[model samples]
Target chain A: MNTPNSLLIRRSRRSSNLSFVALGLVAVGLVMMPYVVYQSVTSSMVMLFVLVIIASMWNLLAGFGGLVSIGQQAYIGIGAYTVIVMADLGVHPLIGVFFGALTSAMLALPTSWLAFRLRGDYFAVGTWVIAEVYRLVMIKFQFVGGADGKSLVGLSGLDPVMRSALTYWFALGIAILTVLGCFWLLRSRIGLALTAIRDDEVSARAGGIDATRIKRIVYLVSAAGCGLAGGILVVDALRVQPDAIFSVSWSAYMIFIVIIGGIGYLEGPLIGALVFFAMQQFLAEMGTWYLMLLGVLAICAAAWFPKGLWGAFSQKTGFRLFPVGYHVAQRFDTPVDSRAPLFRN
Target chain B: MQILDALAQGILLGGLYTLFAVGLSIMFGVMRIVNLAHGDFAILAAFLAILLVGETSFPVWLVVAITVPAFAAIGYFLQRTLFQQSLNSGPLSTLLVTFGMSIVIQNALLEAFSANPQRLDVGQLATASFPVGPIAIPYIGVLGLMLAILCIVAIELFLRRTATGRMTRAVSDDPDTARLTGANSRHIYGLATGIAFGAVAIAGLLLAARSSVEPTAGSMRLIFAFEAVVIGGLGSLWGTLVGGLSLGVVQTLVAHFDPSSSILAGHLLFLLVLAFRPQGLIPARSL
Candidate 1:
């Protein structure tokens, strides 16, 4: 004796057509943005692409996998160092970018085995230790500038016009590809499993999900993305310091961007990076207080809103900017017999 | 003889490490929260002592007397205001919140006292040392070890002997049951933070006399304390001491042979221990 009005459970779904249209618009907009900015701003644009790419991967891992890590610098350091290692052997950083990621994947393979042993706090600590190990190990390699951090002197001698354009285009392609990859991944069945795992790992496992394999895949992907991004970072900086490249501060910045932009969603780090860059415009002169401010902001965000800005915005607006999948619905006004038939069919 | 000397000194330093870690252990023992700010609090206390002594010309004991209760009060407030509510949210929230508190405290201290390092001139304690079978034992180092032992004994006794101790143990065991038994678990949480702060005070006294005081000193101390806690196992008090000693010995041995290996040696030791036995050296079985 239930009311027909109460029987309708409307699932929110974007028609596959609207989703593709939205993607095309965003692609066009991103393509057109570079002509509108200054030279330094344009140069910095490439850096931002890499930053967002790496931060997005981290955001996906921590925000979705419930695998809160503090040592992602392991991959970043590895990637950059790998690029340098290749460069020492006379491989161009441009060509060695993929190799750098490969190196990160190799490190992650062993690290994931060991780091997976640690749950929660221990995991964070273990990852940090691993990063330290990477840093220490790097110091033992003299070709990459043990402590001094060698300059990419020869790279500068290459045709300046070709080099800059190629690096920019390379970063752009990677950024776009990573974003698309994340979107596709999130829209898939594995994405559904990831969200399920994030919500509750035990239940997800009980539901026949290969939680470990899923997490490993996510970890490996995250590592590879970080590795590629890191190589680009060194190329941009033109030199890589063991301390700076391997710094925990990079991870901290990644945390800051994700927190501010909104974690869990693909666009969180994108928004976060933009917000962080804007804030840096003002807070850059604040010196050490600036770091403290970012930390405090992240803490406040976590304390007040665990769902992050993205979750909060979604709840308030009832709209998703990046719709991964569709929700099919049956109108409440439809006859029960008709609705039942439609559902059954 | 050199090896023996290293071992003895390591054991002695382990005492200080024990002192450094026990307060953190006590907190974790009663409440399953790890204060990422544990080492920072120790450094802060030491700096406070330095400031206190400079201002009032108080003896080190008097400084500790003042700082212990003062820090206990701060810890009590920190728990009552912030952590008490978040306890049920589990460790992640606790870690983030405490990490925030650490940033607040470190920045506040950094602002109050710049990045310049400070040290205490502990009269004879700093330089005074006696030979034990060809090993030089500094008075300050001996003090650190003795304090560590004292800390262990006192905490163990306090946890076992007193009615408050029983209540604490009960609360730690099962908060709901303790609540049913008419113990206010919230108040107990404050007391736990207070006890932790008291232990930090002792560590601060010993640490200031031992090392140069700087803002980042907390994180560094925290690193050792963390390693000790891990080495000792999750919740055991004595194991912390063993953990500290083992870490100290490992570091000393590395330093003795290869100066560069000192920090690396400690990290590798921790990794090796973790690889084989993640349960730690001494696991907290009861709570």
Candidate 2:
């Protein structure tokens, strides 16, 4: 028996070369999307961008932060209302989107204080109640057309083509930034802390992690992302309504996308958003049936494939575009010795 | 006089709310799973009652009597199948599955019944009011209150005295130990859900008698029931009634001052309670 002469220290592979190539191609395609796609297609892409952003943020919250909120529609509604109100005050709709996000983040601070009181399922319902309160209160603001809602006032001056293009670009930029921001956050020290907390809260706390502070930050960030998406949605629609914007269906859509694409994976939202968009394009005309199908699909997914489409695919292929977990690789140079045991179990 | 009337009306309103929440309270207490489709199930019961009355020439009361047992069967079947599978997965999976169920039920109802609001006419009972000193309360309101009280008492007694109910309590207390003691936890869960559905069916009839119901109405009802459950405490049956009454009174009082803020007032109170006393006003002793 020969003793091992060489030792290798293993480190997890972060990304494949193929992943970088794919990312490059996707970035270029997005940049030239306005020229490559028709106006109608561009408009639909706007919807896709907004959906992806919202779904990704939701994934981060529930997938990473261990906070499953069904009330993100509150921030969406608030953000839309903020843009509409700002437009009323003679501000450019473009500039108001940031303010909308800022306002949402501010509101999230107080909301987290209240929402964090409850644990698990209670938190889900509590967030929903907060959203309902926001909707009801918005109906009383007679200046913003109250229950009827209002249209964004100042966008009529811009050319239709220019406005659409700009909105599309803004959405694209926001979607890219949200994905990168989440990826960056997850790779940071806080991300490791979050992963620990997600797996076992008691143990994480016992390990000296401040679960409350991390959760608060994640909640605030999610609100800001949803807020920006909401702003973009109103801008694309050119109208805002309390009933429509504050509808829980928005949250449902986000959940569906996240669940279908891959709940915890980084690329899951993009894939989920595209699948949803395709379905919506084809079946939206069927009206209630389309919604029923979505419901059925969501239920089936939760029951049969809780890990989602990407999750199952990754398990089989060992492929990850945005790999966060570590993977060990064995060096081929070390000769196997059956009696000495080739590798540590 | 106005304030007194408002308070009386609010308390009466709370009776219906208690009926809505008792089912939720039971399901939560026994299984620790908050059924997101609970409001949709109640609305489904209402629609079923309406269909029965419309198709057969059965009277409203008979329709309710038939529907209650039918809903119980549905509760049992759903628990044994879909809910049981999801429960094994985890609490979050159960939540998502129920949420999906809610969506499916709402859309199916919309497709079958259309979006038109439907009401169950109970002839003279709906409009008839009796004088309680200076206040006049509708007969339906009194009936709802009496029915709610009867249901709560019956459930309490059942849980305390009956063999199956004791089994349920045992399971709720400790599922693993209950299993070790030879109790079938799944069957117990199904029974609890069945009872909960029966209660919801009765509540649905009361709701239809009081006002119009549509497919979308389930969402609001869900919020109200959730609020009442949270306010009352997680596993406490009697506390649910008190929570419902408090919510009703608060809404009515706000309505008396400003009608538009009535719903908002209840939600605000719920939030305040959540923020200040996360354990709830009358927390369960087991917790």
Candidate 3:
């Protein structure tokens, strides 16, 4: 009995509810991973979490905000460096992680002013140049270890197993926070403005969206998130080398993950990270050949499947694990059936 | 004397950079696509030249002559197929495709020719240089500067005078109108890319002659070329020379004072130009 008089608008569907349960299960399993898996396995999982955080942040910036930055490793280096420096100053490395995020966000405010001068593709190269600037500047600062870089000083006393577990937990928590934060941000008014800006900047501005302000906010968030990931990376590696930390390869990984999994979708990074991690593990023996293959696959995905693997899958099934869009359902004036129709055409 | 020497060397370095940038400018001007693989393609040419020199009995000049034309053909085919399709999809697709190509080319080169840096054996030319006052100018550097000027002049003339060049300009200005009026935009685009590729191959040969090149050397070259283009102003051929020269002078001067800061100084100059004068030192009237 369809009520012609009234229509109900909502976001979640039956599939979303099922997805919630599945996600909750996955979360619990991830939290319990260290207990069940070997130490080496948990150590590798730490990298997976870092990838998730960085990829999600990148998606927020490029996919949603239309800022295709190719130099995000600047913040990654800053974050790692901040953590190392903080530890050198006698502050705990764990506490320094937050400082990493804070420092990156603070630096991003100034960087946006310079980077925003160039539009579209030029913006991409501008950011890369800025990142190069950051790397060169870092190399000059001998107090912060200069080109030689510094080690994670404060973590010398912690037990190896305990430290790894703690690192894993921190990574997991941050990855989850990044994803949920992005989900909530998208569901808010700012997210709507970002979607509009992404589709067409001129129209979005014409429609009263403060495109610059929103884009700035997204850029800051992305910088902070990448910074946090960098902090985690240094803790895992136990040393911070300027060249290794600030390498553009980090940007390449983020771009490849976003393009392969799904560009705009929230779930895309998660799925892409799993696939990337698997590939990294299996193709470890292949040296740089596997990277070439990854590059080829990314090109194919961009050319043929522009929507990416997750995007194509969702388009076919009309099922969203993270239903970020609204749908309308018809309701009668009288009491309707308790079971809401799943397919609300 | 040191400063004078640096300036002379810097001018020569700028010539090399101008060569790299001209190809990039052509691609961007015609297609509104920044070829991220521009540097990688240049590197590939250098590597190929090295291989040819090692394996074949041909002279270096003969190898360069063969490779330049060969790369032009390759460029035309790539544009007709890979780049054209990516362009049809949109700007993001083009960026991703080119970026992916950069990584693929880099890794493939690494696989084929180890990580060791290799240089083109220009024999006695590498060591020969003449002194002017307190400054020394290498014969190879002068050759590169002459080549750079020659390529830019040739391209400028081609785009300005040739009928096909007019077709390219028309397509760039209004693709839809050009298509309606009987010009095949695709073919014109291919021609532009072919010219760019040929120019970049020359840059590669020069780079190899000047210094050693490795698989990983392409990214910095891309940055240098990109900086030159932006500082010179997009779509302006002569402006690229101005931009490249300024960048080279700044880097060399900085290196004279503090060795580690040479590249940083060049990058800083570029950023300053970008911040203060985004239009470039001498913006073209219309490319």
lDDT of each: 0.78, 0.87, 0.90
Per-residue lDDT tens digits for candidate 2, residues A1-345, read 223523322323435557857887988898798887888889988999999999999999998888989999999998899999999899898888888899999999999999998778768878999999999989998999999989897888899988888999999999999998998888777888899998898999999999999999999999999999989989999998898999999989998998899888887888899899999999999999999999999888887788889989888988888756655544446555436543331
Could you report the DockQ of all the candidates, in the order they appear? Answer: 0.47, 0.80, 0.76
lDDT of 2 by residue, B1-287 (tens): 99999999999899899899999888888888788888999999999888888888999878887999999999999899988988886557778888899999999999999999998877899889999899999889889888888988998898889988888899999999999999899999998899898998888888988999998788888789889888887778778888888999999989999998999999998998887877778886641
**Per-residue CA lDDT of candidate 3, range A213-297, in tens?**
9999999999999999999999899999999999998888898999999999998999889899999999978988998998999
Docking class of 1: acceptable
Candidate 1 C-alpha lDDT tens digits along B163-276 = 888899999999999999899988888988998888887787777787778876786677677788788887788888889888888888778888886878888888887888
Error of 1 at B260 (Å): 1.1
* lDDT (10s digit) by residue, model 1, range A45-122: 786787788888888778777676777887887888777778878898887788989999888988898788777665
C-alpha TM-score for every candidate: 0.91, 0.95, 0.96
After superposition on all C-alphas, the RMSD of every candidate to the true structure, in Å, is: 3.3, 3.6, 2.9
Q: How would the candidate models be sorted by lDDT, starting from the highest? A: 3, 2, 1
Which residue pairs come into collision in candidate 1? Answer: A13-A327, B232-B282
| lDDT against true structure, model 3 | 0.90
